[model samples]
Target: MSQKAIIEALKNPDAYDEKVFYVKVLQTHISYIFLTGRYAYKVKKPVNFGFLDFTTLEKRRFYCEEELRLNRRLCGDMYIDVLPITLSDGSVKINGSGKIVEYAVKMKELPQEALMSELLKKGRVDMNVMDEIARILSDFHKKAETNGKIESYGSIDTVRFNWDENFDQTREFIGRTIEHQDYSFIHRAVQEFLKNRKDLFRLRLRKGRIKECHGDLHSGNIFIADRIYIYDAIEFNERFRCCDVASDIAFLLMDLEFLNKSDLSNRFLIKYLEYSGEEEDFLEVLPFYKCYRAYVRGKVTSFKLNDPNITEEEKERSKEIARKYFQMSRQYAEEIF
Candidate 1:
């Protein structure tokens, strides 16, 4: 089924349950999510953005399965299953006995108020929650996959590749969203830091700090219910997800700082370091990773300006957001040598 048809079908509450109260459709750059009171169904768009390709039905199915399987590790209870959307007699049916046209990952609908991002807005994220989050991530990183081959991604070359890709992709927005001088200065600062800090990367690899950690560990992905539920791991690309533990943690820390919660960010980082048993010296190399995380965010936000589905108002908001993130990235770069 086309995205429109699939979304229309999901908008009907009876698609999931006859007694369901209502259905709400949410849109992202790459997916359409249907919130059916009790469950949320995420349908990936048939688009190829170079880094990820879900244009084919087979690829969508595979990624749906991958999303369900991978997210189950952290929030098994929330990730329900992947269901096929079938085209029948002039209508679409979810998990119906017809020709399968697309796939949707079903999940238990978590309360919006419990989301860490939302909680942060309400000023409800306290020390206890931060400590719990720190402990959960520490344990997760400890058990994450690490091998000789995956560890190689922690090398300076791979780091360079990631940054180069970022710089190349965002080059067009240099003068519009990002200042030319700031871009060039941060670019050089990052290159010099990576070139000069090979020993830090090497030390991380030797100590097994590189692993298959969550690539997107921002506040939005975290839910503070009975326990912390960190879902939506990046299943499309391993290069984005697999990295130094500090880099993974840096994303969340950067997100907190972006939200202007430096007190919480500092508390979370200190507690995380104490729990992970990492040396305090690890702080020295964190700003570099934070800059990378912030730059990636700006790149993503700028990409939304090109999305046709969003309104003009949204584009204006995204423009401001992209500038804010780019400035934050530059701030982190300034902290480096």
Candidate 2:
């Protein structure tokens, strides 16, 4: 569909004017999120990246359903269903009995402060909340599925691949944006640490420390409503979701530090280790995984600089966010070595 068509669809009064319905646009980044009364509808953008494939109507529908199914594991009562949007002649209608043109995952919207990210920003986050989150995530990881076929996911090769991808893609940006001394320090730290810790990485794999997990478990993806709810998992790619559990937790750790709550981050890590009894293993592989997580954030935010949809001011803001994440990755690497 054309950009104008998409915008028109978004502005369609009939779609939101039903007596029983009310629509509000929530967020429009990688995907479009809309709030319809108590329900939130998420529609995948028609973009084809090698990592994610939402390019076709059929694929979008399939992934929309997949998102509902995967998210239901955590938010069973909140994830309602997946609905199709049909186009006939020139008009669009949701769940119409015509050819499916697009798809959206429908969900019950939670309160804004219920989101851990928003809570952290307002200084409402606390250790009790972190402990609760730790317990919830630990239990989830214990029950998460593991792929018996992918040996690489638990091996040194996976660790190496993570680093190689990060360094190769962000070296130029890091060189340009970061101070020379800071950049060199991080580079030497990563090299030395990886050289000396190859054996530890392999050992973690052999111990079943790697499993399929929430690929993106940062504060933004978690909700604290009576219980911790983690949603919006990596439904489009298995590689993103399947890996060492430490890698999964590292995302949260990186997010906490990014929010300037290092004390809480440390407390959360310790509590998670205490509950899961996996502290030693996590300590061994955490630095590497945390660095990987930070770099991934940097890489993703950097794409905003190239997006035509974003204004110049937004692009500058994205660049600053990307730089912050790159610096965080460097700091994690230095702390490890």
Candidate 3:
């Protein structure tokens, strides 16, 4: 089906469920999301990034199912199921009795105000929420999958590859988004830390510190309802989602720091350590993961600058946000001192 057909189908709420209310459409670089008041349907775009491929109908459907299965680990009720979009007689409809053309992952929409990012903006995020999150994450990590194969991802080589990929991807945007000195300093710090702590990375693997974790844990992915719903686990690739739990939580830590909530960040980490029963010494290697996480945010925002759909003003804003993330990455690297 054409994009025009999809847009038209989106306009008609009847295409999805039995409802007449208007459906809201949200777009990201890789997906078109239709919000139908009570539910949201996410359709992956036919894009091929080297790391993830959803370029074919079959691949998109597989990933849709993978997303539903993986996300249901953390968000039990949020992820409903994957529904096939059918096209026939010059029209497209979701779950229609026709030939399947596309696939969508249906989900239960959470309240906008309950998003942790929005809560942080209003200074409404408190230690209580942090503590609750810490507990939830602790329980989650305990039950998270672990095996020899997944543990290998925590090796120094694998860890370094992740950092190397970040540096390589962002190198072209040096002067345009991040200062050369900031990039150089962070690169050197990360390399040195990884080199010096090969033993620590190995020890983490030996201790089963590596597992299938919530690869993306920024504040935006978390909803602070009665229960904390950490949705959107990386389903496109296991390499992205499998790692030391420290690195997983570090993403959230770096996000809080990016929002200028260092005190809460510290509180959250401390509570996490307490609940997870990880030693205080785990703090030593945290800067490494935190820096990596910050760089990832900068990298992602920098990529947004090149998107054709983004307005000039939005691109400029993204440039500034990316710069700030790079700056934060440098600070985290400095903490390694």
Give the C-alpha lDDT of model 1. Answer: 0.88
Q: Which residue pairs in model 1 clash with each other?
A: none
Which rank order by lDDT, best down to worst? 1, 3, 2
Residues forming the 10-long window of minimal summed lDDT in candidate 2: 11-20
RMSD of each: 1.3, 2.5, 1.5
Q: What C-alpha lDDT, on a 0 to 100 scale, does residue 223 get in candidate 1?
A: 92
User: What is the lDDT for 285 in model 2?
Assistant: 79
Where model 3 places Cα greater than 4 Å from the true spot, the runs are none
C-alpha TM-scores of all predictions = 0.97, 0.90, 0.96
lDDT of 2 at 323: 86
Residue-level lDDT of model 3, residues 74-176, one tens digit each, is 9989999899888778668887878998888999887778999999999999999999999989999999999988988888888888888888889989998
Rank list by TM-score: 1, 3, 2
Range of the 10 consecutive residues with the lowest summed lDDT in candidate 1: 13-22
